[model samples]
Target: MQTASGDTQSRLPDTIVDESALDELLSRPSPALQSFIKTVSSPLVILGIGGKMGPSLAALALRAAQAADHPLEVIGVSRFKGDGARPWLEKHGVKTISCDLLDAEAVTRLPEAKDVIYLAGLKFGTAQNPSATWALNTLAPARVCERYSRSRIVALSTGNVYARNEVSRGGSIETDPLTPLGEYANAAVARERIFEFHSRRNGTSVALLRLFYAVELRYGVLVDIARKVHAGEPISLATGSFTCIWQRDANEMILSALALAASPPAVFNLCRPEIFSIRQVATRFGELMDRPPRFMAVETGLDLLGNPKKVCDALGQPPVTLETMLRWIAHWVTTGGRNLGKPTHFEVRDGNY
Candidate 1:
């Protein structure tokens, strides 16, 4: 991949997006989703339906249920089903169960459903605590999938499983060989492999959505850059190109997978059609805020990224454009999104969960 000489400062072209565009993207379901909805014989159970992006996914599943004309008992599974999400799910009359999937008792209690969305996993910088990441992020799902291999499973994976950029031009693909650069991603790779192994042995249908960055109320990577620039701190960079998708549209793609998972062990790259360098993302924030970004350049490789191919084909389109989604985030930040709160990951130094 040839980059310009002043690559760090070479910003990608700008884009403008509107609310109508957002609505339109959310309206359609991916082919994979349609397949799951049309053919799966049971209700859909989505684990991690209570985490960062869970609320949006839960809402999408309910809407998909109504649109597909299928009887979907959409259940939200989380360790502590928070109240913030309850309002949205309750509005849709979505069901929820509070339990840690890691608990044998909890796994046993999960209601039988033909289509399952395994959304539960540890997210974020886990290089410091490899074991804990391996346990919750990798081991738990492996166990749960084994417990319910008969169900069609749409297990969540990460773009992190792919090799870091320099090798990936646009990004990674479904059959791309994996190189786990960090502990967090290694566990994630392990999680996906567990499903593959089980599916091979038990004939369970599975699809691994290799998710890249998905954004909603909170500041995603762009906002992270903005916050640093906003507060007048220097933004750090490691020459990397990444992809992001709006949560609303991204959720629709994942739910679509449950319906698409009728086949055994399918892997799809979940990301927007657009690819932008880390610096370009920062510049967008600067553009929206009408300020110049404060940034320092360096070379970086940990690109948990993708180019949306499988998702587009399966979900009927690519994830929302980077600029459109970033615009939404900029608006939220300007109006004060008010920190919706995030999960606490293990400290990098503490090799504990």
Candidate 2:
């Protein structure tokens, strides 16, 4: 692993045995992250800390703070709803608050902080109840921006905001249009627009990160492919290529991006620079799990992808590689490791999810 000060270290585990081990791995801060945490002020507020990536991200920030011996207090706010994330975050020394972001008064009553990380958004089930998705994706951000107008905010957005592009073009750059396909994607664009409006109006410094995917052992694009291959299900190649960053790397970059926040709201596409072929990834998983993979559909030559050059130039390339991720995910799946059962639905070109 590469530290923020540009030092090299070996931290990758051979295999993740269970959730405990997996959480530790995900929450472990890299040297780069530890170094960055020192610069952050106390009471780093993380909104929507009850989602799939929230607990580990909060833990990573806390671990980084501890490593730097910085007196940084990490507070995570979410409705929680009895999810296992609240307990895990509390156990990791992150202060937890149960509050619905949609309640304007509830958001106003939250503690104050100069630095904030926004992670709340709805993607799946958008087709079933799009009004809920729009309210959460658009309204919640509006409230957060209004409350944290003076804070340096790092907000999570999705690459689904971009229209499909040719594979030969590498991927959609940060300047690409936001005319994406479905309700979920349009709502995501509205989320970004809301943040931008608030930032411009209030002179708030903000960074918008359009992340493609964040992969880990339990659930992600990698796990989705690995499970299908292991079960001998036909994999689709219609959306032939995509991009992702390891969850840890994504968390670290998101924290580090606090420095990139600015008036007018700097935007960056967050993911590994390399474009990955779905067919190749499935075949690699098969080799690792000793299973022959089945495939269906053909490459459409158009897919939703992101170009990470801007962010990679600002922060270094993510240290974790594709081979390491494949090895870790394959081992976890074959060993009866637990899965979150939440598919990424990466193949959905219609942007339904």
Candidate 3:
């Protein structure tokens, strides 16, 4: 990563806006970011921006554009462009373009760009469509990257790319061997391969963020666990160590990585400073909610992973603390957390990660 200096504030063109409000995007400056920074121009495109992380990511990009004094034309893509994500995006002035990304034709013909934040994925739990998941998560990005090789790409990957035991290897380095345990990880792995093929072929400067757990009140494992316990449901435990970061912190980490992409096809584990145990998480949630967290602890051997030392050393702050994360989920559940939602890949059972 480049030495992010105070001059970053000054060298920042008239377009630079105060990053105080956009904490997630401003927390760190990646090597790719500095490189992307020098070349900030309008017509920025965020593929699959109509989904989960799109709104926040787009907003942050605009802020970066504002700081640089370059007028940014942000395009957010998805199946349809209204209601679901429209409100959140419009609140930040991000433009939307509707297209069912999984349709190869639509994805193939999508406009090329300067910077593309690829965030679309079929990322729910086992209960989702496997083929659909494969197509959306890995295949689509691979295709999109091929079409837009000229654009700087930051494809979101998961820490799942690392095998379970590999995570405990003093921080699973990006080069660790293939050990994806489930369909989700398999898809992510395939996506990375696709990027590699195109990168070598077209010299695409792409960054694959092997993100770990990103927690927020409404999403992730903690929230699901909280809802189950609150509703008096029985939970099972899995055996594995895991890592987590605040959603905002992960976002900042990603933005930083974007600047550092040029140093080869880089993979940075996006997580918090602490590696947590399943027991600790369960206990924490129980304490905060003032409810007993019931569970049958068993070994699933899944990779309950954590430890984000790399990014912490390079960037500046830890995403979310264990205590704060628990508190946030607890408060959210009490306010109206709802059913465990449609069990995402992160629905917790017992003490497993």
Candidate 4:
């Protein structure tokens, strides 16, 4: 793991890293991303840019092109319902397009671009509205693929598509059989299949990024644990261990995937190579917050983990390590940090989101 600047570590303040500051940090692209951006063209369109990962990712793409001395028009597409995500992205020089991906005509009318990053999908409200989840997860991908059939696409996928793997075996690889547990996981698998089907039929180049939890101070597994620990609540260990990457790392790798797109869509697991234990993560958060972490469950054999060796080999590992994220998140949570009100539901052992 890459060590972050010790100066930044030593000077950590006792306050929440505000939204703007965190966004700026996440938008800073790595050296690998800059080199990869040199190979791509302008007018890159990112669908579903309103999501947690999308805004920074869109910003990262724009920054990478600038750093590489390339002029690029980066467009972020979303419904623009609320959350100020659209405005924030636009402020970072990302062209904003308001369109609901579910509306087929709206999707068809979207501008043609040389590259596409599909980040649109449903996950959080799967249990109550399974139909909506299926529609967005599977149907939306099909529509996006059809609209940009010829363009090189890098679609965001979830690690939940794979069955829980034993901890000793490390994590699930790209080729592992997907035996996802609930409606949400199954729908995610369907999402991948839809993209694969279209990529095969239209001869479109595609890359499926199977990413686990991507963490920042705002949301993700690390935030969930940090929040719980800071509040002096007991953390659950039902899921045992999991994998995650910093938001900056995930954003850079997602942009780099444009170079890996293939006619027969290639799959790559996106997460830190290490499998992190929930108890240890919680305990670390406790230490940072001056509170002892309370545990509620035993470590199970099953865990939602992924093997990111392929992506690490291709795009290089993230500069921010898990320990770095823990330190950042701990400080953020202990000092009245704001959450995006989204939970990872990492406690779900039945695979239900």
Candidate 5:
């Protein structure tokens, strides 16, 4: 993926945080984002904004509003167990609010906004604590939707809502039947239903974005694989294929989806519009890192994949490409770039995440 400047390597430095590279990347405004900013009113509330992608998404909204010359308030809501995310978001002109969405009173007290982005959910560790996963995924959305029933909401969802598919068929489309495995995936389905029910009952505009995986320098499927390869660990090919999008690309898409929210709650799969071979991607990473790629499992034909044709047609191809992201990830990892220590369990097939 060639960067916006077409010089992929020279632009991205080793220190993403110290130099505010992530801020710059996330805040870069495009036509779609600028247009979305103009359509919505002030005070866009991003619920559950403490997750891996929440801060950047909130900052992106703030910057886009600024760039559009229609500056509006952007508030980030989260438990904020620590001060790290709050400080960064506050510094970026996003109002930070520490509110646990699980608490009904806390949600009721939340300042209402015209636009809301739902990024809160639990995925990993669902095997042990299934109740928490269900509660976070289902109950949280119910509270958010009930509180802001009239706001145009772009809720984040997971592609895991769809069962595994073969790489040959281009992956699952939005209209495909959802037969997701595991408690977490089922919980995700319930989350969408809650949002849909609210949309129907209250005429709240809703858009559910089912993302496969998002990759960046610090944390993502690519980063996880790169770290494993760097540690001389064997890459698993059990789930042979996957779909992913660059972090900024995914964030931008999420922002743009605000414009696509409908009364009946539209569904869009958020990912690169192509199926990627794990072996091929890992081998490419190995070649870039000058490390021999090690493989450990037989390629299983079934895997979680998504068809982003609808979104691609609506928003066009993401600015960054898979190849460009690989180059960036390779450079970042080789030069001792930081990882968020959050591993995406892309290898898990039994829905036991």
Candidate 6:
């Protein structure tokens, strides 16, 4: 498969042997990203840098800056409660500031930056403690938007904000309704609303990216399916189709999205344009891992999917192909590679989690 940039799938490594290699792969900046970094101003502040995608994202921005010789200072802010992401970011030359975004005063103390990437949001434990999820999703954005009222902010939202769409209808577009099920999804909508409100009121330039899923070798929809196949576990097909982009591609586009920020916040669905079938992907993982995948549920034909045409038109289609991702994930699973133990729960049809 050829990427939007004309690069072929053969350029990707056959197998990521370990975490070191995986980190390097995820943080590697593309040529387009390097050029984009040149246009970004110094002191790029990335909020919630302790999350799964945050460390590598901060590193990717720093790497792009280095490649472009832009002399950029990448600052990552998060509640660094012995998460180890702080040290990893520090090792990558990203300045780390420990701050709880829920505290408005601390948010004000954050260093000024013309460009900010908001990654702070809670999702996993929403079922148990919906209040925390709501507070984090709603409060953090309010504080950050207030603190960075004049900055260009690229906030990461989720595809969960939209209800599941018919498989034949492609996927949900940006203008689709935000009527989703479950507390987590609703909270995500609130996060976007807060950013939109602040942008409109303060004339803040903001870009809200509704990302479907970002897959790397460790933990994602692909890894979930691959591990199920490798472990002889049943792969659920209740949620038939899904969408994902390589983490590197997602992070690069996220950084590039700073250019898309505008008053009232420009919205874009972030994912590969192609919709992936759960059965097809699981079966392919079975083939790659030399294990037959077990099936449990039937396909509902409705899923939480996103169409990336708008973002792809703005920033080129993600370079990593589904086949490449499947191959890499299967290899990692069979080799007993370490996983984050966090399942994407992509099969959930009710938006729970």
- Give the candidate number with the greatest lDDT: 2
Which of 3 and 5 is the better model by lDDT? 5
Clashes of each: 6, 1, 32, 0, 2, 0
Off by over 4 Å in 2: 1-9
TM-score of 6: 0.97
TM-score of 2: 0.97
Q: Per-candidate TM vs. native?
A: 0.81, 0.97, 0.80, 0.94, 0.94, 0.97
Q: Is candidate 3 or candidate 6 better by TM-score?
A: 6
Q: Tens digits of per-residue lDDT for model 4 on 227-281?
A: 8887788888888899998887788788888888998899999998999999988
Distance from true position, residue 45, model 1, in Å?
A: 0.7
Residue 316 deviation, candidate 4, in Å? 1.1
Writing each residue's lDDT as its tens digit, candidate 5 over 40-143 gives 67888999898888888877777777878886898899999984999988888889899988999999999979889999999888999999999998889999
lDDT (C-alpha) at residue 21 in model 3:
30
Give residue 81's lDDT in candidate 6 (0 to 100).
93
lDDT of 2 at 253: 89
lDDT for each candidate structure: 0.65, 0.91, 0.64, 0.85, 0.84, 0.90
Q: Candidate 5 — which pairs collide? A: 1-323, 1-324
Question: Tens digit of lDDT per residue, candidate 2, span 42-84?
Answer: 8999999898888899888988888889999999999999878
Model 6 lDDT, full chain set? 0.90
Q: lDDT (0-100) at residue 264 of candidate 4?
A: 83
- CA displacement after TM-score superposition, residue 206 of candidate 4 (Å): 0.6
Better of 4 and 5 by lDDT: 4
Clashes of 3: 32
